[model samples]
Target: MYLRRKPIFFLFLLLHPVFINAQFFADRLKSFMSTAAVSAVQYPKEVKEFYELNSYRFSWLEKQNAEQLALLSDYIRSSPSLGLSAGDYHPEIFPIAAIHENDSLLTEISFTDAAIHFLHDLMMGNKAEPLSYDGLKYVPACYNAAALLNVYLSPGRFANLLTDLEPKEAGYLAVKTKLNAWLKITSAEKYEDVAVAVSKTLRGNKNGLTRLYQLGFVASDTASLSEPALKAALKEAQKMFSLLSDGELRSTTVQALNVPLATRIAELKNTLNTLRWLHCVKQERHVALVNIPSATLLLYEHGKLVIESRIIVGKKSTPTPTLSSTITEVILYPYWNVPYKIATRELLPAIKRNTGYINANNYQVLNSSGKVVDPYKVNWRSLSAGNFPYTIRQSTGCDNALGLVKLNFYNPFSVYLHDTPGKSLFGLDRRYFSHGCMRLEKAMELGRYVLTGNAVAIDTLTEKGCLKNQSPITVPATEKIPVFVLYHTAWIDGTGMLHFYEDVYNRFSPGRKP
Candidate 1:
């Protein structure tokens, strides 16, 4: 019994210093946390909770944590390439020379605070500014500080964790590469603003030629070129600006060319932020993205672009909203149920003027009981916008407002993607003529893509003749495809060329500088 007791006593003696050191660290942390200075920590609550979870142990000060500390410092310093400000991580407070000093506790806490803040920004967006447009809802991935720290502290995980968190989408990576290149170029040289005379043609303007040369649109600035060569260069510039490539310089093209380089950089940064907010798309198998500013629709399957189409969005008075939803069904030979506002305010005047207008346009007037009524019998002149109570719907045919097909999705905005009879609108450089819904140039293609296995159904409906269809045929989606209606003024094309577009909605702040 005496020998066993002696062994237990020796074990206790050996463990005494470990317990005492833990208590000492806990007491110091508690005292410091109670002071007002702790409030200066960016994430004080997370920091305290982290230490408490580890029994008040010093994590960054531990010798084994040196690798992760160095990696984190590198990531923080290089964060600008990710469209994040390194200063936000408090890099100046990193304690490289104070590991053995008496103020090491403060240094530990500061480093921990920086790590938490950096991880938070990496997982979620920096959210430095509110989105310019309303009705844009995108929620990024989320993770707590304690959980992220545990993963970072684990063996052989720091680098892999970062790689996982970073966006791997081709579009995002292309923009990031361009942003880094621009940052280096801007730091090395001051870009001179190109001045273009609006009254003169850019074909013969020396300044315009130099600007085109600088932008790599033309081969040479000093050498004299023929009129055809100059026109071609102007067309290239127009294409880069996502304008009409008509080989003629217009006032709208002049505005794009005169956009300052610094403003372009700011636009790139805003694009990065927008992409980060939409990070959830990486996990999806199929996605349809509509960029309103560019008036383009891109369909992706298994992370590859499957289709690209031109789309007509809403006009200025009724701008299309940015939202995320899933396409659930496709309607063939769909009827257009004109909204109450459009029916009352827009079509009412025409109907009153011409009693035969409704039948000429294939529009039917339905009363409260859902029965068709003769438009000629109704008192059209007596019905004002406020007093009109009938539902106006267009019949199914090639001439229907929603031509051939319609893609249905649930959104509070009551907007959906559909085919339009105005095929000529797709040829325009800027197509924003819709009321609020999106008008698709290739609605049948999109319908088939969403209904992958049942694509023959679309062909069958179309072959049966549009005028013969009495009612809309609905095809439920086997797998609902996600759709994101976005607004980006700057984006990198597949060829790695960056394209800038007009801020159609005036979403960017006025008088903003880099």
Candidate 2:
């Protein structure tokens, strides 16, 4: 009797759509969250939260869900067009997994996993290994795991969310488009060699000129005057690379041109990663960004750049730390509270050479109690750097290295942006000459901007100097402006022109391909 009924019961279960779909969803969830699959990665918590939020339902199982999943898969596969790798997000295992009526559960799980990983990479970058620099303070795009799951699982919003995850900064997008165009055009061609034309006009390969034209550095000069036009093209290309516009296609220029497309793509990826951090941050009406690699500070008001000035960053040895902080105050005629490293390595030697160097440089030596010690009476030879306990303070005067102003920010690095009397350094295109602090070319203008966020304060400060003819005046900001000290080797400008700077500190190590 049991055997006779078993066949009919099995047929009933097979015919029931609800029962079949339920089993499919369960199988998909189990395969997706399998310990062997997700145990090694970072998304277990996120995956768990995702499934729990939907009560273990298959996210991409239904027809409507599958349609959205298809769109997402296409986007993931086209990552290379954006200078990213689809493989970086494990698209093979899930996001682009083929969905069928049978094993639809596994396919749905795979697709959901792929979407999560893709979003994570888009928002946080695909860098798996730890970077060497701890100085970078990256505030990653934050999201609640369950909330993100709900959005990605939602049929109406999932596609839009994928679109929104991309970095929308004009410069970043311009580079992305430029890279895509380059890849598209060069897809069929072999990498060609650029001939060196150092100290002379280019004679070999008008192909170089064509390359430059394609790269958007040269305007159309149809008149067949090769030397002058090519020279102009070289100069423009040099300028784009942040080199002196000498108008000669030297070995360096050739080398820069010959940098493999792979290198540029990697650089674009790095820039994209950095841009993600900026995109995730709270957009402030007024802010200052110190791009370390460019060695420039850009001041923005209402998201428009008000001014840009050359800056001196830390040397490669003592690199400037990347961080996000707020500028709360500006000090005019600021004192240079010398760091211990400087006191030992720099000042100690100067004092040993000439005891008078202390007074001549307007530096005062003080004990821990703040009592000034006469430099002449102190035994300079006996004071070793490690054993030294006194603080070296430079007075507010013409010779002071801190110059006329200092923009103070809150950070553990104890570094601030300040003025330098050695303005000649600004003329040099490569300006990585400071200790750890940033030396601003337009310190007075920046100080005023921080204080008042406009030109009024700058005019008053320039005309009358600080209040009451004071040696030092501390001006508090009415609203603290957000400051980001970042390092980006490649970026685009307002005119959609790409700019590449030398990696002074070698912050980006092109590890294994993404």
Which candidate ranks first by TM-score, i.e. highest?
1
lDDT of 1 by residue, 1-514 (tens): 0111223223432333222355677788777777777777888988888876777776655545556666666777667777888888766664244233456667778888888887777666677334333332545554676667865677887766667777677778767776776676556565575676564455568888876765566777687887788878888878878988877767877787776666777788888876666555634678888888888888877657777888999998988888778899998888899999899878999998997989889999999988999888899989998898899999997789988889998888889999988999999878889988999988888998888899888889767756733699899986788788877789755443667777887877463321
- Model 2 per-residue lDDT tens digits across residues 307-332: 78889999999889887778888877
Query: For every model shown, what is its TM-score relative to the native structure?
Result: 0.78, 0.76
Point to the candidate with the largest lDDT: 1
RMSD per prediction, one decimal? 9.3, 8.3
How far is 167's C-alpha from truth in model 2 (Å)?
3.7
Worst 10 residues of 1 by lDDT: 1-10
Which residue ranges in model 1 land beyond 4 Å of their true spot? 1-59, 62-71, 91-110, 116-124, 128-138, 142-165, 188-192, 198-236, 246-249, 452-456, 492-497, 512-514
Q: For model 1, state the Cα shift of residue 350 in Å.
A: 1.4
Candidates' lDDT values, in order?
Answer: 0.75, 0.68
Against the true structure, candidate 2 has what lDDT? 0.68
